[model samples]
Target: MQPMSRKTQYFTDSVIRRMTRISLDCGAINLAQGFPDFDPPQAMLDRLAEVSHLGPHQYPITMGAPNFRQALARKCGRFMGLELDPDTNIVVTIGSTEAMVDTIFALTNPGDKIVMFSPYFENYHAQALFADCQPIYVPLVPPKFNFDANVLEEAFKQHPKAILICNPSNPSGKVFTYEELKLIADLCIKYDVYAIMDEVYEHIVYAPHKHTYMATLPGMWERTVSCSSLSKTYSITGWRLGYAIAPKPIMDKIKQYHDFNTVGAPAPLMEAAVVGLEMPDSYYEEFGAHYAHMKQLFTDGLRRIGIPFTDPQGAYFVLANIGPYMKKGQTDVEFCEEMARKVGVACVPGTSFFMEDVRDIVRVHFAKKDETLLEALNRLEDIKAKMA
Candidate 1:
């Protein structure tokens, strides 16, 4: 038999998803993957029930369902300070995963260089490789997760076709500040590079840390492909509703990519999620507050258990340092698996998210219920002894 494609031959299964399976096998509380154990908004649930019976069960428009895109345009425009045209500027995707990959395929060619921050979400590197692109990784130096402007400019100077930014970044939870984003915008403009933004945690920012839209910066709208999803914001990761917003010329290509890829997001789900997209400002306020509460609950529990973790400025994930808990010569992968089996908690090994050799950190999420987080923490209280 012929061998598999070289593009994927070297790829291992997703470490995050693998940890979730390990958690299941061990009957541990699963914080490995970032999905919520709680319900989505009751409004979206109610709408979904109605849509099941009312029936738009078949595929909607190739670009997206019209009402869904319109709601997204209004909601995103209100926050982004740009009047988005749903018809010409948006292409709904299966999820931000699809939105991101589709944008990459649409914007870049094989062998092109793509700049991305180190310790990125695992998917970005895979997506670049799938497009046959070279990734230029700029480290978001750990502890504070800040980048030096000089280092970034040097990456930009490589003249990459596009740069991917995940504000309120996963694994690190670093929210790029306005000044930092402005510097990035200036560099992109100077280098004539495109910016692909993954702002999935846009609404989950903690106080004193703001989420700035890359497209909102001056001279950036024309070159920015803003990708986000209803998954994180609406707590409907399974529904897989996401979209990309770009200029008409760029969006035309993205729509083609999305159309051929997923053929549009789920129709009934889109219909249901429009209710979420149209939710008022108060809904977002309450949403942020709920996540803030969860973050505090989980992080405070970690502290009391004598576990050291990075307090996130935005997003629901926390990277806990487990170096002290590991056995001699134990890899993070082994430690995480052992953690699930013996410690009754699960997390993704930090090795999955970095270009550099980082193995002492594990990424866990606080998207679960208060009771669930409490139980995980309770189980973790004796982790030192259990792992030993």
Candidate 2:
């Protein structure tokens, strides 16, 4: 066999994706993967159907499909309050997964340091490693899930080459406020470092909590690389379409890496996504409302059972604190495995999402049918009773 890459040995397969498979194997109600169970809007489906038969199914422009890029540019410009050049500033990739990977590869040299907030999307750490960049983790403290400004500033003072910021973050679902973004921007500017942002949940914020676009900050747009996916916005995770938006010069290099790496996202999917990218303001309003419904139903169930969970400001995850019910010897992972096998429900352990002490936490997904969530809640009640 060929020698394995040293990088591959450092990380395990994704715990969330692994739990999702176990959820399937055990025939459990799966709340492990963050994907939504609902179909995308009819407009996108209809457009896809129209394009499915139309020719032009060959390779798209390696950077992105022209129409798709134009639509994305217009949409982002309108929403983010920055003029984006369709041809030079955007490069569509397979997903935010690929976008981040390509960004790291294009920007970082071996031995360069990258600081990422912990409880980050698991892929970020792996990407940093694969690029031969050292990853420095700064933890987001619990309950409130807020970062101390001093700690974040200290991380920047290390003169790290880059920072990965996930606003409306994964796992914890803690959206960074405008002031928070400003603080981070100030540090990045002070250090003259790159800021790669994952804004996948940009549109899913609950009321009273807003999603701040990192690129909108003063003098930050030029140094910031913004990556997002149509998956969360359009509820089309399987479509595998995402993009990186940056200054034309940075995007020029990112596209070179992306071209050699994945070539481009699927042509047909890109065509279909134009509809989603062109959706009206009301589409977003309704999207927020839909997620709000799911969040309410899911959180309300947890509340009824006296289970404490971090109330998400955005994103689809709910990180429930199961500390009270954990038995004398059960680790969070073990408890989650038993929940799937015995209660017929599946959730990811919080420890999988973090690199620190989080034995009493397990993360669940609310992006399922009402009946599905109800069943998980019922099983959780049984868990509570048994532990009590």
Candidate 3:
């Protein structure tokens, strides 16, 4: 038989998911995958229960269920400050994972170049490769996770087809500010490139650091394809309901790809998630407050344990430097497995998220309940002795 597609050789299975499995095997507290251990909003749960018994169990429209799309348009338009037409601007997808990949397929041809920052979500690299596109990586300097404008302009000089921006970035937890975003928008306009935004953590941003929708920037409304999901905001990751909003022209292509891809997001789940989309502004305020509490709880414990880590402005993940605990010549991957087994805590190795030669940093999330985080911190207190 012929060998499998060469694209499969470019990347390994998801290290984030691998660490989750290792955590399960060792009975460790899982800080590897970024999912909350608590229940979703009670209202959504109740609505889901009702939807299960009442209909729409089969398939909805290929674009999306009408009520879901309308709710999404109203909610997103209010926040994004844009008038979105449910019929023309939205394509519900099977999570932002599919939303992103479908947007890539719709926007670029094979061998096109895409710009992305280092220490990005692991899925972006794989998505680019799967689409037969090359990624031009621009590093976000550590401690602050800021990128140099000159460096970014240099990548844009390569005339890449699109640039993927993950606001409230994963693995590093840096939230891009408005001035920073304006710099990118200016460059995108100058270079005539598309901006594919992964804004899944839009509502989870910390205070003093706001999420600026890329499409909201002047001259960007036409060129930006915004992809997000109900997973993080609603704490319903298992629901797998996500959507992309773009101009009608771009969305027509994305809708075509989505139609042939998954046919549509789960019908009953879409019907149920409408409650989440229709939630009031106060709901998001409380949601952000809850995450702020979790962030404070986990980071304060790390400080008490004398572990140095990057204090995130947004997103729940933190990059902790465990260089002091690493054995001589030990890779982050090996250290992570050993830590999982011996210390009863799990985290993703930093190498999984970086393009540069980086080790000694492990990414862990604080999205769990307070008890779970406290337990993980308690186990981590003796990490130096146990790993040494």
Tens digit per residue, CA lDDT, model 1, 24-134: 888999999999999998998999999999979997999999999999999999999999999999989989999999999999999999999988999988899999999
**Candidates ranked by lDDT:** 3, 1, 2
**Predicted structure 2: clash tally:** 0
Ranking by TM-score: 3, 1, 2
Instruction: Estimate every model's Cα lDDT from 0 to 1.
Output: 0.92, 0.88, 0.94
The candidate with the higher TM-score, 2 or 3, is: 3
Pairs of residues at least 3 apart in sequence or in different chains that clash in candidate 1: none
Candidate 2: tens digits of C-alpha lDDT, residues 267-297 = 9999988989999999999999989999999
Candidate 3 structure quality by residue, lDDT tens digits, 1-388:
9887888888999999999999999899999999999999898999989988996899789999999999999999999999999999998999999999999999999999999999899999999998999999999999999999999999999999999999989978999999999999999999999999999999988879899999999999999999999999999888899999999999999988998989988899999899989899999999999999999999999999999999998889999999999999999999999999999999999999999999989999999989999999999999999998
Q: Count the backbone clashes (under 3 Å) in each candidate.
A: 0, 0, 0
Report the error of model 3 at residue 333, Å: 0.7
What TM-scores do the predictions have? 0.99, 0.97, 0.99
lDDT for 55 (candidate 3) = 66
